[model samples]
Target: MQLDSGAVAEGRVTRVTDFGAFIQFDNGETGLVHISQIAHSFVRNIHDHVHEGDTVDVKVLGRDERGRLDLSIKELLEEPEEIPRPRAIGRQSPQFEAKLRSFMRDAKERTTAGGKKPTTPTKRKK
Candidate 1:
């Protein structure tokens, strides 16, 4: 049977991989559910959610440029967010943000550890 975009159907999970799952329908049509599309939340492991021979509901996203069936499971479960998360005021970084936070904490500790004052130098005789 020909698959149409936005069509919902059930299929057997024929193959499961780290990146995605291959599902084969009774009509012999197969589609891919990319790892990111496998769940509403982050999907670190595809095997945790599905395995080979399991039946699953999928929605046809559309044929890609190569004509392969692009499917989704998470989209059917909920609507996507309308707005993206905001970044830091002046920077966008994962590593830098973490490192910056650590550095700031250490600097604060050093500043607050004040305990002594430096002695002034003596004046020389003319």
Candidate 2:
């Protein structure tokens, strides 16, 4: 079977390495799925994701200069939804902005007063 770029196929993992996994298709064609292509998220260990003899579906990313097939399992898997990030301090809510402004005003007032920080009143010995 001619495997073209973007083609999807089922293959059995022939070997697993620290960098990637080698898969052999039914047609006897072998491909390497790089660690980065094994999952959508960070893969600290390739063995944690795939092992020898495991059947996985992969997409043909294309061929290397040496005619080695470059495959990707993540391309065949569903992409994870992006998690929303908290707004930056500059883009904080109106309430937060008000609080910040009040604090800044207070600090500016203290600095301008005498460059001295406020001291708590201490009790004198009786």
> Each model's TM-score?
0.61, 0.64
The stretch of ten residues in a row with the least summed lDDT in candidate 1 is 79-88
Q: How many pairs collide in each candidate, listed in order?
A: 0, 0
For residues 10-111, could you state the per-residue lDDT of candidate 1 as single tens digits?
Answer: 999999999999999989988899998987767778999999999999999999998889999987887557533545477569898899999999987776
Q: Write the per-residue lDDT of candidate 2 for residues 1-126, one digit (tens) a residue.
A: 789999999999999999999999999989999998998888889989999999998999999999999999999888889733545556789998899999999989987677777777999999
- Candidate number of the best lDDT: 2
Point out where model 2 deviates above 4 Å.
83-126
> C-alpha displacement of 67 in model 1, angstroms?
1.2
Candidate 1, pairs of clashing residues? none
- Model 2 lDDT on a 0 to 1 scale: 0.91
Best candidate, TM-score-wise? 2
